[model samples]
Target: MNVSLQIRDVPGEVRDAIAALAAANGQSMQGYLLELVRREARVARNRTLFDRLAGKRVRGLVVDDIVTTIRRGRDDPDRADPDVA
Candidate 1:
């Protein structure tokens, strides 16, 4: 399925900038804008999925505990590999 989209009252400078970008990429304005819309939709979908997953919790695991462990690993010289120097 396909549909048409229309944008009303786009400023001249904004339109010109998009036109320049399309030309630089050897694409028509329609093709460039379509790609932009598709990419944004993908990002939005991924963000929604991430938000859903972030709301779930695992037993015996906490975000602050993970952060503290990571900080300790970085700050503790005794924890560093002796051969890395």
Candidate 2:
């Protein structure tokens, strides 16, 4: 389903800035706004997924532990394979 959205009583400067951004990106104002809304929706969906996983255990693994292990591996210079280059 598609619906039209209207912004009432917008300040001239803000509206102009949005128009300039849309033009610079080679999109019409409507297209630019639609993209922005779609991106925000994806962010919201990801946040909801994270919230749902906040307290549950997945195979007895802690999220923080997983993150720390990944970071440690990333930060170790010796982990890089020079021969690959």
- Best candidate according to lDDT: 1
Compute the lDDT for candidate 1. Answer: 0.95
Q: Looking at candidate 2, what is the lDDT of residue 81?
A: 65
Model 1, backbone clash pairs (residues 3+ apart or across chains), number: 0
Question: Can you list the residue pairs that collide in candidate 2?
Answer: none
**TM-scores of all candidate predictions against the true structure:** 0.66, 0.65
Q: Candidate 2, which ten residues in sequence have the lowest lDDT sum? A: 54-63
lDDT by residue (1-85, candidate 1, tens digit) is 9999999999999999999999999999999999999999999999999999888856788889999999998889788676787
List the candidate 2 regions with Cα displacement exceeding 4 Å.
Answer: 58-85
lDDT of each: 0.95, 0.92
